[model samples]
Target: MSSPEQRAAAILASQRFVVIGTTDADGPWTAAAQYRLRPRGLYVESDLGSRHARAIAVSGTASGVVYDSSAAVADADGVQLAFSAREVDATEPAVRAILASRLPRDAGPVAELDDEVAAVLAVPTKRLYVLEVERAYVFDRDAWRSRGTDARIEIEAADVWAALGRP
Candidate 1:
């Protein structure tokens, strides 16, 4: 059987999008954004004016879920994350590297990718955000089987990174 860390890593790596939840003075908000996963965190692109983005900017915190929507109810599995989030400058080397890694092999040269990223970030409203995960949990099927009730098991962030073959 797969460990919780393995399950979380699989779900995170395979999922293309995450529904991020954030809060502001008015109330809570959720928005889905396509994501690229790295050992450090999950990266997403959004507009600075977006509700979720604005909320993150204010609170510096967010929670998100990544799951297979196509899965049957009985077989459903997902990762729940609590994170510190912030807008990152696209010109930063780390940001550029993350963006470049997500591109297809044939997408083009590194310089071209940097140009594209720059063009997008140049829009006053657009920004790149990173969610640095603090805590994570995965659905525990073994617990469900044993107790006949849904349950989640906390997986260490280090374990999740290790599962991804990172230090």
Candidate 2:
């Protein structure tokens, strides 16, 4: 992990829904997506047949906002990332391990997915996608810290991780 990666993970842990923005020839589109953080990217499991899924597949590029909305003031802490997204090999060891670990925690949307498929409709076609950032900026109250995919910021990722660990 790196500083940007650390910041990204913190943002993910602190927030549940991400605003996903994409564009097509006719116009721009956006949707709120539930996500989980991975070492190198973020994961979103969505209906395979939906427009949200189709947009990501067609463009591969996306920008997302993850914000801690419980601020005392009008507008506050958040992070925004520009990234690429694609369906992942769910069986890949790393991906599998990460998903499994988060499952027990019942993190956000993962909880809904863990339900018995005993729903009105048959189990839907849902696939996990990896959203890897090309660049990102973190807004901590009033200040901003930014880094490219290279994480040109000087901080070590490990330090950031340790500091942000949940008490």
Candidate 3:
């Protein structure tokens, strides 16, 4: 049987997008965005003026889930994460690395990558956001079976990263 960390890694690796939950004075909101996973957490790109981004700016925190929508209820699995979110400068090396990784091999040479990153950064409204996960959880099937109730088990972020083959 796979460990919780392995299960979480599989779920995260199989998904391209995460549904992020946030809130403001108005109330709670959720939005789905494409993500790039990193050892520390994940990165998402969005407009700085977006509701989610604005909420993150105010609260500095968010929670999200990544799961397979097509899975049967009995076979369902996913990773739930609580995060400290912040807007990261696009010029930062890690941000640039994320941008570069998004480029296709056929896209062009190094110069083109530079141009692409520059163009993206040129847009004042667009920003790169980092969600530094504070806590992570996965469904505890053993507990569910034993207790006849659904539950989640917390796992270390490092374990998830290791399972995903990251340092």
Candidate 4:
């Protein structure tokens, strides 16, 4: 049996991005953005001009979801964990390097040309939130509930780095 930590790590390890949910005076907004899981928290790069970036700057609240699709349970019942956090600008060289490392290769040369991507680089924020896992449920049609828990998981940055086998 997979320990909760291992299972959680697997969920994160398998995914490179998360749907960042933000709120404004109007209502809530959700968008899927690429993220780099680091020894500290989750890192995301966005254009300073994008709606999401503006939202993060004005309000630090955000949410993310990670799940296990390989479970024996039904497809709809895959184990999923949703979380929330506070945003921190990943402006420093060290943090940028960490975030860069987590980026999917398919991200292309978007960050390669320093001049063209300057707007995004300026706001490369690492989201540092309380990471409240709102829920964890199996999506399987029949055996879903038997496979998961609605437990609050405390995942530190070190743990993420450990799972990645990074120092």
Residue runs of model 4 more than 4 Å from their true location after superposition: 68-143, 146-161
Q: Locate the minimum summed-lDDT window of 10 residues in model 1.
A: 99-108
Give the per-residue lDDT digits (tens) of candidate 3, residues 45-81: 8998899999999999999999899988777788999
Per-prediction TM-score: 0.85, 0.62, 0.84, 0.56
Instruction: Please rank every candidate by TM-score, starting with the best.
Output: 1, 3, 2, 4
RMSD of each: 2.9, 6.9, 3.4, 6.3
* Candidates sorted on lDDT, descending: 3, 1, 2, 4
Write out the backbone clash pairs for model 4.
Answer: 76-139, 77-138, 77-139, 77-140, 78-139, 85-129, 86-129, 90-125
Q: After TM-score superposition, what is the CA distance of residue 21 in candidate 1 from its true location, in Å?
A: 0.5
Full-model lDDT for every candidate = 0.80, 0.60, 0.82, 0.51
After superposition, which runs of candidate 1 have C-alpha atoms over 4 Å from their true positions? 90-112, 143-148
lDDT of 4: 0.51
TM-score, candidate 1, is 0.85
- Candidate 2 per-residue lDDT, tens place, 99-152, comes to 654422234465553332223123446567677766666654323323212222
Candidate 3: how large is its RMSD?
3.4
Candidate 4 local lDDT, 10-80, one digit each (tens): 66667666677777777888877766555434566555566666666677556666554455644332234
Cα lDDT, model 3, residue 102: 39
